[model samples]
Each structure stands twice: as C-alpha cells, then as structure tokens.
Target: MTVDPPIRLGRAADAAAIAALSRELIEEGLPWTWQPARVLRALQHPETNVAVVDAGDELVGFGIMEYLDTDAYLVLLAVRRSDQRKGRGSALLRWLETAARAAGAERVRLDARRDNAAARSFYNEHGYHEIAIQEGGYHGAVDRIRLEKWLRA
Candidate 1:
C-alpha cells in the first residue's frame, strides 16, 4: 500500500522542475515562456500562489494562480502524464480555488487551448463555464478558450 504525494506551496527550489513540467505538459506546441526565472518570480510574488505536488524524487504536478481584488487567474495547471486521472490535478485546482476564495476572490478564470477537448472537459466538470474564445491568443499563434467559475453569488 502506497500513499500519494501531497500538494503544497511551491518553493524557490522547485522552480526549475515546475517550469520544466509546465513546458513539457502545458506549454506544448506553443512558445516557451514559463521558464525557471519566470517561475521563480511567481514563487516570490505576493499575490501569486505556486502550488506543487512533490513525489519525493521530483515534482509530479504544479499550478500557478494569481489572486486579484475580485477574482483569481489560474495561469497554469498540469500533472505529469503518468499521474493523470488520479485526482492530483483536481486536488491542485481545489487547493488553489480554496485559497482564492479565502482571499475574497469571487471568481476564478483560466484559459485552455481550443484544440484540447480533454482540458475543456476537465474544466467543465469542475464547474468552469466557457466565457469566450480568443483567436490566436497564445503568442498570437494558437486559439484559446477562456473559462470562468463564480465562487459566490
């Protein structure tokens, strides 16, 4: 019987691995912007939360969320391919959402590539609604679907 890794706030030391995971899983087919330096900046940002799941050996998943006055922006979320469908992604998302709500955020927003049906379905299952579609949103190269979830009435 083996227990799964726990999700926690990402540390500066985890920046490189998190950025690598983001590049491999989330930023695929797009320009690489979430590099280690950028990730470290997020880790140190006052309004940003960089959550990560450490698998002892390395980071198996990570999510970055920025909290604002009225809402939160889920900048990125991704779990390792081998760890998908095991609730890790959901746990990360829920953790981020709870933090946002605690910060007085009434809504959470994110974007997914238009071609990623799996990602769209995942967000839909988690109560996010499609708010709009931005043509060539990713570096003016890929179409993106914007999603939002209201945390309160």
Candidate 2:
C-alpha cells in the first residue's frame, strides 16, 4: 500500500522547496533563468498563482502560473524525482487549471522542451495541443513546443 501527499495552495515559504525540486527535476542543476530568488519573486507576484504538494513537512512538487482576464500561462511545473508518477504533478496541474478557469481564463498556454517525450505526452494526454515550435525558444536552453488547451466557457 502507498499514500499520496496532499496538494494545496502554495505560500511564500514553499519557494525554496519548489526551487530545489525544479533543480532536481530539470536538466543540469537549476537553470540560471529560474534561480531561487526568481522563483520567490514569481510566487509573490500578484498575477501568478502557485500550488505545492506536501510530503510530510517537505514540499515535493509545485506548479506556478499567471493569468490576465481571459488567458493564462503555465510558467512552471516540477515534481521531485522520487515522487514522480504518483499523481502529484497531475494534481498540481489540475489545481492550476481550476484556478485559472476560476480567474476567468478561457485558455491556458505552456511550453515544453520538444525532446522531452514524457512531458509532451503528459500534456497531450491532458488535452493540450502543440500550437507551435520555436528554435531556442526557452532562453536557448533547447527547442520549445508551445502547447495550449481551451477551457469550457
């Protein structure tokens, strides 16, 4: 038997945990573009919303997003390596989508590294479609596939 962690709205204090998880989940250490300080700033930004999944007292996963009147952008979503495939990432994503829809977002957009077949498949399974591909779109880290999903209005 196994237990799943609880997912909830994120707070400022979760910033460090989320940043660490991002570093662990993503390529080669944390990208310079998403240093801890930058993550903290995003969590505190007025337009952004963040959610974290807790493992005992530590956060194991997180998702961050931002929105305007009728549009939203999924800026980041990461899960601890040990916690992958347990539904934490999907929970955070569902929470973010619900939050975005509640905030009047009619559509949500995100970008994923095209080479990451796992990520691309995850998004596709969740109803997101690839809308574009940009060479060096992600700060030149790699080619990017832009994905978007329309919400029921």
What tens digits encode model 2's per-residue C-alpha lDDT throughout 1-153?
544457787887877777776666654422556667888899889999888888888888889899977889998898887888888888788889999999989999998887889888988989999999999776676888999999975
Candidate 2 TM-score, C-alpha based: 0.90
Note the residue pairs that clash in candidate 1.
Answer: none
lDDT of 1 at 80: 92
Runs with alpha carbons beyond 4 Å of true place in candidate 2: 1-5, 27-30
Give one digit per residue, the lDDT tens place, for model 1 in 6-121.
88899999999999998998889888899999999999999999999877787899999999889999999999999889888888999999999999999999999998898899
Task: Give the Å error, residue 17, model 2.
Answer: 1.6
Model 1 deviation from the true structure expressed as Cα RMSD, one decimal place: 2.0
Q: In candidate 1, what residue range of length 10 has the lowest lDDT sum?
A: 1-10
lDDT of 1 at 81: 91
TM-score of each: 0.95, 0.90
